[model samples]
Target: MKVFNEIETAKLLPMRELMEALRVAAQDCVEGKIVSPERMVVALKEGGIMLSMPATADDIAIHKLVNVNPRNSKEGLPTIHGQVVAMDALSGVMLFQVDGPTVTGRRTAAVSMLGISRLLAHQPKSVLIIGVGKQALNHVEAIAEIFPDAAIHMRGRSAHGAQMFVDQMKSVAPNLRVEEAGVDHDVVIAVTTARSPVYSELAKPGRLVIGVGAFTPEMCEIAPAIVDASTVYVDDPLGATHEAGDLIQANIDWSRVKSLASAFSEQPDFSRPIVFKTVGTGAWDLAACRVIKARL
Candidate 1:
């Protein structure tokens, strides 16, 4: 069995490769070539912590156990932390252990990008990202790799954090314009754990919005206005209904929401203001594990 730390995992799975793998995985899922059960969750306390268990299998099986503590901010620690275990499907032998948080951030960003690839028309010229945490950083890196020409706008709850992210990102993409904009962009990605809505307005007529925060009904990153203004799509029907705050808080008709699997499989009109909300799924982790194992 192999053990991969956070740094090692980052070195192994670059943003570009991860995004490509996730795109394939998403297609496989839409085509019913993979089996990914809905993620299971256990609340640790009232408004405190929780554990999410997600599993996925295709040629091999893997499970990711993630711990989420919203109160970790008081301790000056990350709110999300965990590890992933990959095992042989036929033999049931554990194969690898990788940093769960790293995988989560990478896979989540890649998954959002995968949805973007499927739903958007032309590649975006700029992307506005809300939040400056690990997931936000990963989103910037992934978007930069996938859409190199796109400018990046980062917004954080704290001005200091947003500026810091901008400074660090400029070193990586010197030619890439990084700014703190209000809401002008071709693509908008909300990755904060904000309990309230962070963005209310939709982008341009044909823009795309990807919401990665609010894995639970209690938290929401994008506001209700955005949900109302855009056509919505979800990775999983049950996952989105139970985990996404954007949909839950909006009081939008559940019947109007479309599943990505169905949309991709049936071929839907991609020329519209679209909102893709993902609570993250075990199937994605499984897909990522398959890629990692193959590379290994």
Candidate 2:
């Protein structure tokens, strides 16, 4: 089987195309054209996890194996590593593989971008991103690529951390800056692994909030008020039930939460506050796989 390195994998998953691919996959998942079961998680030593996610559709299939080791950060090592293998759905032959972390970073950001495009009424003028991890880097890159005109802001737990992140990202995003004065922005994305809420403001109109960092119930990035006050949406309704910590912690009505697919079919009341929480699933990986497969 052909194997692509991290750089090659990233080259294949361009932001615009990856976002569009995720757009199609969102609906396919709703239509039952793609079948992706809940991911399998196994414990690893020192607060690590092995995640196995598989999805299949009529045209193609993919399996993503990811290892997340939080302790690695202290060792100056990458926190996540893995591979995504594209395969023939009928014959089950692995055609090619891409770096796992690359797939996860690009596809996760694509999902958020799709939400931003569908949920908001107007193009974003300014965006505030919380956290400065690999996920944050992907979101910044995706935003620069797709929303070049929009001003990008970053905020970490500490001022120093935020400044460091801004400095590190200067090469890719010269316009990126550390957020100051805590002003209102067009869109707010919280991608941290914080146990407590990182964004606590109450919901307001025209502000699209996306929570991407918190996956488990114990991890929450948005406060309960924000979730309860907004017309909430999730990229994967099935995965959100158990993985979306922001909504789960709020104890809101599940019936009120809409799917990303619903937004494509119908227009939402943009006058109301919006929140799009995504836990992610294998269907998105399959979408990324399909994108690269066609290009090759």
Candidate 3:
């Protein structure tokens, strides 16, 4: 099998291309074209969990193994570590191996953008990103490409982490204003693992709020008020009911939450603010592999 490390995967899958692939995959998922099984999660003895996600889309098949360790930050390591193995559907031959964390970080951000893309009549003027982790960096890069003129704001629990993210952003985008996160923003993407709601209030309408973190029922990053104010959408209805902490803890009615496929298929009401929540899916990994293989 061809081993495409994190660096290679990053180089092959550009934001624009990856987002486009996700768009197609989202539609396929909505159309019931992709087969992605429920992720099997095993609890680790050291206060973390490991996930095995297997999926197939057309001729591409992928199995993504990921782990979440809350104690990793103390060890100067990433809180999450993952890898993806790509295989051929017809022959069941392993084709390539890539960094799971990188694919996931980029794919998750791109999926968020795909949802945001359908909701936008125009480009957002500003975006607020919660947490200065890898996911935040991916979103910043993707947003810079999609909404070039929009300002980027990053919020972290630690001032040092936030400042470092701001400095890094400034080096690549000097003219692009990177500031501390606040309520006065056009789009809000929360990627934190906070137990309490991260955003209590949104100051404006036409705002897009994305919750990519807080996957488990124990972690809650979105407030009940935010869910009440916005029209909620999820990547998958069934998965959301089980894994989406923001919606589950809030007791959100599954019937009320629209799927991403339905949102793209029909003309959704944009009168209220939009809250797009994703727990991440293997179909995206399969789609990402398709893009990666084509580029190579």
Candidate 4:
């Protein structure tokens, strides 16, 4: 069986193509052409979590195992690490194993961009990303790819870390701008693990808010008021209700919730602010697997 490490996987999964693949998968999931079991998570010490997500569609089967260690950054290690395994559904034969973190970082950012592409009426002129984690950096990369002309801004909890992040980003894109976290940006992406709201005044009208962190009920990154005010969309309805703290805490009307799949069919009203929250999904993992395999 073939094995691709983290670097190889990251190299294989290009952002634009991966985002499109996820868009296709999202449509398939809504059409009932795919089957993905709910992810299973186990609590670990020091506020960490380990999860297993498995899914099957057509002739392909895939599983992703991930670990989240909140304290890893203190030890100079990445907070997330994992692996993705692919198999032939009919023959039950193992096909390959790829680095989980690479697939996840790329796909998760792609998922958020997918939301932006489908829901937003226009390309953003300015973008604000709150948080400097792996996801945040990847989100910047994806945003840069999708909206090449947009000015990029970043904010993190620690001022020093935020500066460091900005410096690193400048090394890559010298013209990128760094700004304080605020409410007026055309696109706002919150990727922090803050238990409380990151920016309380994020209820600005017509802006696109992508909440990528705060997956559990105990963690709330986006303010409740923003969630309640916006026309909300999620990657998965059931997963959002159970796992998205921003949605659960806001007590959003589930009947009004729209899936990304529907965006593929028709565009929703973009006059009001749109909030897209995802708790991640196995179907996305499967979609990413297809991208990696095809590239190989």
Q: Which ten residues in a row have the lowest lDDT in candidate 1?
A: 174-183
Tens-place lDDT per residue, model 2, 143-234, is 88888888899999888999999899988887799996867798999998877899987789999999999887778999999998899999
All candidates: CA RMSD (Å): 2.3, 1.0, 1.7, 1.5
Residues 1-296, candidate 4: write the lDDT tens digits: 89988888888899888988898888889888779988998999999999999999886899999999989989999999889999988887899999998888889999988887777888787888899999888888787777787888888877787888888877565546668544368888899888989966656666888889888988888999998889999998778888999888888889999888888887788888889998899999999988877876
The superposed Cα distance between candidate 1 and the true structure at residue 48, in angstroms, equals 3.7
Which pairs of residues collide in model 4? none
Off by over 4 Å in 3: 175-183, 202-204
lDDT of 3 by residue, 153-191 (tens): 877887677888888887654434445534367788899
Clashing pairs in 3: 83-100
Candidates in order, TM-scores: namely 0.90, 0.98, 0.95, 0.96
- lDDT string for model 1 (1-296, tens) is 89999998777676667766766676777677767777767767646554555565557778788888778877899878888999888788999999999988888888787777778887887787888887887888787778778788877877777788888888665434445546457788889888898878744567888888887888888878888878899977767877888899989799999887665566656555789898877777877787788789
lDDT of 3 at 104: 91
Ranked candidates (lDDT, high to low): 2, 4, 3, 1
Candidate 2 vs candidate 4: the lDDT winner is 2
Those runs of model 4 whose alpha carbons end farther than 4 Å from true positions after fitting are 180-183
Best by lDDT: 2
Which regions of candidate 2 deviate over 4 angstroms? none
Instruction: Output the TM-score of candidate 4.
Output: 0.96
lDDT for 119 in candidate 2 is 94
In the predicted model 1, the residue pairs found to clash are none
